[model samples]
Target: MTEAALTISHLSIHDRSGAALVDDVSLSVPRGGVLTLIGETGSGKSLIAQAVFGLLPAGLSVSGTITIGGHESIPASEPKRLAALWREQIMLIPQEPSAALDPTMRVKRQMALAGLQEEAIKPALAAFDLPGSTADAYPFTLSGGMAQRVLVASALGVGAPIIVADEPTKGLDSDRVTQAIAALKRLSAAGRSLLVITHDRRLAEELPGELAIIRNGRVVEHGPSAGLLSAPQSDYARTWLAADPRHWPRCHRCCDMTSLALSAHGLSFGWPKGGMLFEDLDLHLPKGGVLAISGPSGSGKSTLGDILLGLRRPMAGSVEWGGLDIVAMPSAIPPLRQRYQKLHQDPITAFVPHLTFARQFLALEDVKSGLSAARDLPPLLERLKVNHRLMNRRPCEVSGGEAQRLALARILLLDPVAIVADEPTSRLDPVVQRETMQLLRATVDQQGLGLVLISHDQPLLAAIADEHLALGPRA
Candidate 1:
């Protein structure tokens, strides 16, 4: 048997308020083997990863011996050696993939941060089937999935023995998930240990080897993958098992039975020198239905949403809303669009930090130009589960989930025929994610509004969207 690369004995961590986030927990990882950490939100799976890398937040206390490399144990406390050790011995793959990547830096700069060569990134990019130019593009320019893959490549470039994979598949489509899992397996085959942490049960099942279930900061169960998955002991494990994607299959069952509420024919869009982000692409969203556009990062899903929302005029083709072409309609006629609201990829950037939700939603007029916006705001906020108290708080004062809810509420007040949401659930917790998607799907359905959900989350999309149009490399 291979030697254990990392071992945690009686590890415990607590936050500023003296609340224990990661209770006394122990785990052992053999070198080059795959051990997945499975749990739900606030389960402290990420706390374990953060503690390993000396990334605990302010006022947080940690105690434990982190054994690495031939019994030379380091208590996460030794700042100097631990910092150096962090850069070399144990590397971290962060929870937020986008944050790990710099919007300003090119891939070369990121490679340099991890003491790697820019030229060698090609193989890493290729492992995820990314184009050769992937290493040359900026993070903002890359699609969500591409940006995610780049971060993984950067981690691999660092060449650490143990990798703490934290929800690495977030903002990725199913095909990319396949690529990521296969790549991790290849790394394991190359004698590198992997600790895959996720709430995605299907992902845990795909990983070969043992599985450890963590709940409320402690390991509730640990054993062989199949043994744990087939018949979990703890209620938490059973809950996670129930959430597994294996129970849900049959791609796009919602598509066939639903009618197209909103659609585009011969839809093509482009810029000065680049190829069309969307070219002759056709799609549809049934009334009160979702149409998921799943694609690799940067494949024009956002552009397509903008095109459909009449935000960006396409170079060619037209978008039909209900019965009329929203894009080609004569602007001479007043009240340009009947129903459309857009929530962009970055809600934080889109929000006015100083403005309260009530004030923001209050800005919507019966008519954007001259006519009053047709709908009222109170029930819209209620439907999204945004509290009346939360309405008074500024965008910055609220959580990401709350801000997104208000963003949706603001759109809801517009009383549009469709809601074009880009990465709506990307950064939210799974439970919050499901709730948000469910709320939006329900709202759109009841209001007769079409939902054009542009996302990389397959399982979430599967539940809400009637049909999916695959784009980018996988398409």
Candidate 2:
């Protein structure tokens, strides 16, 4: 029999709107076992973590007891207790690793703060595919992938007995993701407890223990991993599984329609300070068509997306929008901000954190006034299929998928002649990814908007795109 390490009962959390973010939730973690908390964003999974560790933001309130290590009171009000708890026994591999990790400090210095000695830092880096020499480099100086490994490495070095990993692999590649997962298994095997918080069912399935599905703040289902995944008993579980990437279907209808909405002529673009990110490059997106720009991470796809939006000027070559050089037509540039929109890779950081959804929408409204802006909500929400009910909720109050959908909706509202999206599916699970692309495609078709999707994820592209182009090998 396993020993209980963490316990919760009748846990509930509410946002400023007084809506229960986590309705009634309860679960337990055995000492030396791994328990994954899986749920969509705004489903109260993160709140549970915050409640357990006492880390919720200001003004938010939580109820019910979160007992850790048999103590009824977590003593979260005591910083010394929280800090000590963090360094010695429990830790969080935070959801946003980049944000959690300080960009100023050197990797080795950060690792030392987590309890590892400088001499031991090399081994830690090696464990996560980081160079042994990375200890000397600052966090911002490292690549996104490198930064992620450091985040995990710092937490692991602390020798925390219980860890709450929230989307720990946000910036990691597949190989590093595997390594991180294996490391978690090793921790569990060694008598440390872990609660992996993620939306990825596949990762949840691979852990050597139980799966608990939480939705709208309740434990909707709990059972052995294999059985629950193979034959889910709950509707929420089934919906989640259906949304998994493995079950997603590609859009076949989108292929029949294509009418060139944007094209490039001898497009040679480079940095004046001189890095030829793209040189003598050419690509096109048909009217109402979905064109996916695919490649590995950091391959300059986002750079090209920014260029297309006229946010950056190219040193050479030309980009033709409707057969006219948009660079030369300074006249159309003003309206283009509304006509050409972009949804960045990360949704949470992309939004103004403190603003409520209504406030953010109002700011957008301030850009282009009147009732016509209100015209965007219904069809936009219906097409995107986001709950129109969630319109008033703050960005922090909503789920990750919901936030992504909202970001997409804002782009749709602008009704640009061309839409340039950067990795719209990277943060989403398989099912959501496919559904989102379909919605994006449908929006483009109905409005005759051009779509250019930038991503390193292939399966998503295979599902919705009319044409595929890789950056370095692009034609």
Candidate 3:
């Protein structure tokens, strides 16, 4: 048998209290082969990747043998040795592209720092469908999908022997996802081993490799991707596969056009240094309705949401709520702002990392009028199907799905009339994504709340949106 490029033997990870997070997991990736890990949120798939790269948090304890390129070491004991392997032998395309990039540096400089030669930066960006102008842009100026492509381009450009990509297509639209898959395939074709962790079923189906279905820290099933995806042996694996957004039943909700909750007229917005994103755009959302926006990366989907929510001033337009133009009323901003809320793509950023959710809720009650008298946390938690125990933990201690649900709960406390959800489930697993959308739909139905959902997932939009708006490139 040919030697494997990477191997994990009897790997187990435990939290500070000795409770196992990953239990006796073993896997291998042959030279030039791919090993894809599919599981629900908090399933320990990313934890295994972190252990291999020695990126696990300080309190966690690891017991495992990770062999990379014929060199063996215990991840728990040999921190420096594993650190030495980064970039040259292995590179991680992290799940959170925004966090992975440096805010201060330009994209071209970051690529150069990732071991790409100065001359190679433009072609590398172009390979990921990023324009030459993207090379000079800062990370913060890029959209979530744009940042994801930048990270993928830079990471793959390094020519590492082993690449561990966690949710590499997290924020990309369908077309960019295809581009990313092509890049990964090229790396594999070049004889580099890959360990891809993702919740994207399309990626799993397209990338031919060994598949491992992880659940609650255990690898419940492992086989060839084609065989397992076609005929999975385990029940959990079956459920996971069935939860893809593509398999979801389409929503038949009809839009109610009479009572407008929010409306935008002749909206035009663009950055001072940039060209117009959209001009003379109009939108309408009735009470208890969903208005979904979709487009290519950097096509102003999120920007339009920001304008409606009053986060950004449109060069020319008015946003009206309840028949009143809120955009023109700067003095009413204090109370009016509470009526419109936003659920961010990354919920972790919406929360304070060090503060517990319970404390944050209390803080919100203190500031927001009538919030304390309106609702309690327990009922909201129950409604969202979140565990009460999670309220005691900080945002960083919970999974992305849990944090997002909690963010929703926080927004609910404000008793908002409308919500602008910007890819709220982009990072979530399929099952959790479905659940979150269901909850959002329920909220819209039950409370007569308007929702402006910005997303790249077509199936999800087809499943829940009452109205669809497709944005194009800036005029």
Candidate with best TM-score: 3
Candidates in descending lDDT order: 3, 2, 1
Model 2 regions lying over 4 Å from their true place: 70-72, 75-84, 131-146, 253-259, 264-280, 312-318, 323-335, 369-375, 382-393, 429-434, 471-475
The true-versus-predicted C-alpha distance at residue 62 of model 1, in Å, is: 4.4
Taking the tens digit of each residue's C-alpha lDDT, what string does model 3 give over 33-120? 9999998887788888888888876667788788887776556446677788888888999888777899999989888888999888
The candidate 3 region of ten consecutive residues with least summed lDDT is 366-375
Model 1 error, position 432 (Å): 5.9
User: How would you order the candidates by TM-score, starting with the best?
Assistant: 3, 2, 1
In candidate 1, position 139 carries an lDDT of: 78
Q: Top model by lDDT, which number?
A: 3
Candidate 1 off by > 4 Å: 1-3, 13-17, 59-65, 70-81, 245-266, 271-274, 282-287, 296-298, 309-313, 317-417, 423-437, 456-463, 472-475
What C-alpha lDDT do the candidate models reach, one value each? 0.71, 0.71, 0.86
lDDT of 3 at 197: 94
Residue-by-residue lDDT tens digits, candidate 1, 1-475: 6688888778898654576768899987888888898765556777687777776654568898778655588796554555667657777777565558788888767867876776677887787777777677777776666777887777767777777788787667777778778777877888888888876655787888889987668889999998898888888677656543334443333443255567788887665544666678777777766778877766778878877777778877877765678678846223535466788665655777677666666666534544232246566666666566667667544444566767776666566766789988664545546557767766765677778888877666776677778776423
> For candidate 2, what is the TM-score?
0.85
